[model samples]
Target: MSALPNTHEVLLRNLNLVEGRPALLGVSDAGLLPECPVPGLAMTEHAGLWQSLAGDTVWEGCYGYEPEPSQGGSYDTVVVFLPKARAEFELRLALARYLAAPGAVLLVIGEKKEGIAGAIKQFSAVAGDVVKVDSARHCQVWSGRNVDALSRFRLADWLDWSRVDCAGVELSVAGLPGVFSVGRLDDGTRLLLETLAESPLTADRVLDFACGAGVIGAWLHGFRRVSGGSPIRVDGIEVQAQAVFSARQTYLNAGVSGDIFAADGLAAIKESWPAVVSNPPFHSGVKTDTSMTEQFLSQVARHLAPGGELRLVANSFLPYEALIRRYVGPVEKLAQNRRFTVYRAVRKTLG
Candidate 1:
């Protein structure tokens, strides 16, 4: 298998810090913080990434947006691993400003291809006088300080909300920068919603796996309401905190009630569902990863009630039909456009 990106190594090697300083790491990978000079607190919304980092004794891990108070009083240094979403990057910067003690150092690291240079300008706005500390292995590290002791950061001010019409139902959707399809509807999800409109699938409970921005779940709720089916309950599982937050806001704004949680795929869910729907994720950071989707296919059987259905939309090129049949049961192609395909699979009866 090809190696994942090496930006973490570059960041670790080039980080300039004194020993024993209390530190906080934001949105980082597995091994990045373990080798740092200071014992650190790491935060990630990705459950799989958290699992990989949980065993490291060098640093502690938190699985959500904010670190618990018991993690430490305050930190002398905070490092943010830049994500692709500009809003999320700003949110992390705001968080770094919030967590770092006055005059404490704040560092940001990312690959040049991921636009580390552009991020420097944004970093300077919140933290003062950014300086490039190191550049190697196609990644650059920049550092600044929280000069203003009285600066207050509010995450709510950073959210972007918009009105969208899906399947003729106007709804409000809100998302922070890093959430998928941040301020608008995605074509793949739109196709899935269209498919749901014509399908005969009905259930009292449904699962929205990989429910980014909560679009699929919220829309499904709306569809079920219009179809006059028995009141349907929706549960959404997302791995990113921002996406989970956005998903919750989407449901709330649309006057829909549902449960959305930050989790690594199906790991945290214990309930078997009558229907499962998703426009599953295929990419992680800058790497093309099908493993997550394949894992979902292989494990979804255990989460489905007898004769339950799994409906998914994917790019036409992914070989999901065979995998769905092998793991879940019989599969059928529901609809396909030039760029996307929708598939439905039924859970088979056990002997």
Candidate 2:
């Protein structure tokens, strides 16, 4: 296994603080905790991490993309690996608090650049008595004590929703912290929506890959309703549990008929669709990582119905045209502006 991240390493530096059963929250790295007599629970919002740890012998409990805490406030030690989004820390803190027992050793570990210091400050306001436990590898581990508190965690409570106009249709978009373009419609997505609005696709069923907050899918549904396009069944695939939850909320509130689920890229999808639309993500954390999107480009052809098309929006600078042409079929640039470009590729039909 690769070496533990600096934040996780700092968390290990103060392993002595662990009490009874332990709970790890927002821990992106798997296998960080050693095997204990009582196997601990490891949970993450990232589907990739959960997939790695699930069914493993070390952790008795593993949950991914689940908002509810399965083990109620039972662990005496709770460690929260800080997330990059400032508001997301509160959501993780709420989860950590719900999982930890009264007087549990609550540890928050993260790199300085990820805003660990600010996280502790905000955590101190709620639970109080926050302290720095350890510092190493440009990361710090902070500790706090959990209060005796029990309130059912409602994912809806954390969502921030807003009404935005896309394709001349007013649609509701809800997003949790860390979800892409949470409160506002991003330029790329807006551009894609406008282009699609002008010439709506003929697909009866649509799959929104990497759909964040279901904006693309929801807007399409509303536009079709007003403009008399073919009715579409929307299916969204998101990698983050938070994004999945938010996307579901967006669809629910907007009266958009859709299903949104968490998955690592396109791994969970099997059925082919008439059209696949996306503003596919290309970042892992704050870093630009294109492997996932490239993988999607590579495998999407198999998931397309005969003569089906893939419509997507990406940054203007990304080199996805070659990959799309190589994998799907002939590619056409539909729209382009200063920051983003929209492309469409159709799967070739057999004679």
Candidate 3:
């Protein structure tokens, strides 16, 4: 009845593949709750859907751990929608093996332009064989069968969770496939760090808005930590479940304490704070969702402390400065590159 987001490939695959067959759906985007028009058998990770679907489900990403048994998921077939990241694809394949029952079928589908054909090489390692289905609308479908009698999801073997340094910031990160920045710091994030106006975070609690892998927060953890751990206790909020997990790992590895939660930006960040920094999330769920960044700015006025600062990075082409001015006091451009711009805003009483 309700509308669905841009992860239509999952929808299309579900419609084309599942025909009253019991199946388990492991998705990062919880928005898939509404699309189950006629639910036969599906377990979703998005928590909002669990109440309606009758299960104890939690919203989470593929890293960290696998979902527990619920309803038809036991002894049922599983289909994994390939994620955008190559590392994630590898991770999902391993998860799929764990989901497959004896003689269970694990089907995967993705867009042709996204290099699904190349993924066959990796899938073959886990599945005995990979079969291709029909292709339409620039998308391709592939199916793999797991015949392993003693099947266990190989999560540990797929990833190497280790401590690494990025630009002098040392932290431990479980950089799984499909996570933001894979195993290293993103260039945009580095640019944002450089652009952020140096405000002593030790004064008050800080916020790392849209923190991916907690790189900025990790770096700030050591910056001027007088006796206590950090001058400002950092909180990172990210929309992606996998991103938040990575951030948590980064925080733990860096010996920093920060809260990383999976929440829609405004709703998750509705609570007030004094200082905020970010490389605002621009890519929508499988689509371009500038509204999220736009909404974050529009609502930042209400949640921030008076005279608090908003520092962030975004593509230079985005019309965010005007949007920032609409909510906060003024926008100051600290730095610019070919593709992005870092902006600073201070909270001011609206006239």
Best by lDDT: 2
Residue 117 shift from truth in candidate 3, angstroms: 1.6
Q: Global lDDT of each model? A: 0.77, 0.81, 0.63
What TM-score does each of the candidates earn? 0.90, 0.94, 0.80
lDDT of 1 by residue, 196-315 (tens): 888846777889999988887777777767777666778888888778778888888876767987778786678889899989988877777899899999889999999999999999
**Which stretch of 10 consecutive residues in model 3 shows the poorest summed lDDT?**
56-65
What is the C-alpha lDDT profile of model 3 across 1-351, one tens digit per residue? 344333344455456554334354455444564454433334343333433344424322232334454321233455666566666676666656665566676676666666778887887777777777657656666676766533555333544465545444455666555566666667777677554324334335778877767778877776545325435578887755556666777677677766886666655446777888888767744677787788788887887888888887888889999888888878898888999888888988855
Rank all candidate structures by their TM-score, best first, as comma-separated numbers. Answer: 2, 1, 3
Candidate 3 shows a clash count of 4
Candidate 3 whole-model C-alpha lDDT, 0 to 1: 0.63
Q: How does model 1 fare in lDDT?
A: 0.77
- For 1-351, candidate 2 gives per-residue lDDT tens digits of 789778777767777877888888777766575633446888887777777776677675455324445677778888888887887888788877777777787888888888877787878976778888778899888778886445567667777878898767998788788788888988999999988987788887899999988998888889889987777788999888888888888888878877886788776678889899989887877899889899999889888998899998999999999999988898999999989999999987533
Estimate the TM-score for candidate 2.
Answer: 0.94
